[model samples]
Target: MSTTTQEAFWSGEFGKAYSDRNNWTSAQYDDFYRHEWGITKTQMNEDCLRDLPKDAKILEVGCNIGLQLRCLQEMGFTNLYGIELQHYAVEKAKEIVKNVNIIQGSGFDIPFKDSYFDVVVTNGVLIHIAPDDLPRIMSEMVRCSKKYVWGFEYFASSLVNINYRGNEGFLWKADYSKIFQENFHQLQEIYRKMYPYVSASQQGNMDYMYLLEKQ
Candidate 1:
């Protein structure tokens, strides 16, 4: 994730276009935002967050324009920080969510120390990474989370490839939550939800979201 060719593809032109295309009308973002942030009215009342404080330490990797962070901020949760791979997205996030820290960095090699956040989250970012690089990214996500990690990504029953805007091997769908549960001894699933593609909000993914607690 040290600015590899794949990383460059994300941090470059295609990534910028992806960021720009997320400008949706509020109604279009009703159930699911473009990148699978928890924006739907129902998602606001998630059970796993019952004990999380308003000032809980939260970090979002690949947080494009900080919309997810903004949602949390509006819900009165401060102490938000986001690290994005694209320089354009970082700048956009900083500009949009002025109070949050928006840094440009890779998820594979996070800049933070171990267990630095109350919850570390990734939104639709993992599948873009090559399978060979995914282990390190997953390790970093767990390494930085003090208690919980959340993911919302494209899903398939097995590892399956999908062309991303004519770029092959750039997108994949898999049971990422299953990978976490099996690979990390301490991690346990607290919640999992899947949105069928036929739903009103067919936001690019047969999306799945999971919450893993490091208990």
Candidate 2:
């Protein structure tokens, strides 16, 4: 596979298929989160982000259909922005999320100036990136955030590749928070939570969420 094969796979027909499969309303998203983690996505946000001002500028990198952004918006966060690699998801997000900026953009090349956003985030996005390219994309998140970098992703004690829809080189799990702290020493981790899946099909999987502040 090419080093950047993930970009093609996630920007083309497969990406559209994934978006259609997960095109859920805010309520549907909350229900899924409640089933998986016993709390709504909004509640998770509130737990991690209660310290942020309601008007803080937040950007979600690789925000597929902006479900997470919708959750933040529901929590009274006024300045929400999202960058999605898939054009189809961008359009769908525009249709679904009111008053939020949803744009087609890549995580490797976030089209924002340094410190443009109060917080930069990703939910379930980093796992799809190639391991060698992770630092570059994550650096973009750090470069754009004025205060915080947050992520929700699959977790493993070490890096491990997983077959995604029978496709190799498409998914991975790692101790993402540790990697972030190691790679960017200036950003200190402020919060973290781990939730093991309660849903039957994914019972063995654990999801991790973390918040890092620029110090």
What TM-score against the true fold does each predicted structure earn? 0.87, 0.96
Most accurate candidate by lDDT: 2
Candidate 2 matches the true fold with a TM-score of 0.96
All models: lDDT?
0.79, 0.90
lDDT tens digits by residue: candidate 2, 1-215: 12278998998899999999998888899999989977788888888988889999999999888788888888899999999988889999998788998888888888899999999999999999999999998899999999999999999999999999989999999988888888999999999998898888888899988999999
> Over the full model, what C-alpha lDDT does candidate 1 score relative to the true structure?
0.79
* Candidate 1 structure quality by residue, lDDT tens digits, 86-159: 88888878777768988988887889999999999988888887777777788999999999998878888888
Report the alpha-carbon TM-score of model 1 versus the true structure. 0.87
Q: Candidate 1: which pairs clash?
A: none
Residue 154 accuracy (lDDT) in model 1: 85
Prediction RMSDs, each to the true structure: 3.1, 1.7
| Residue 25 lDDT, candidate 1, scale 0-100 | 34
Lowest lDDT sum, 10 consecutive residues, model 2, at 1-10
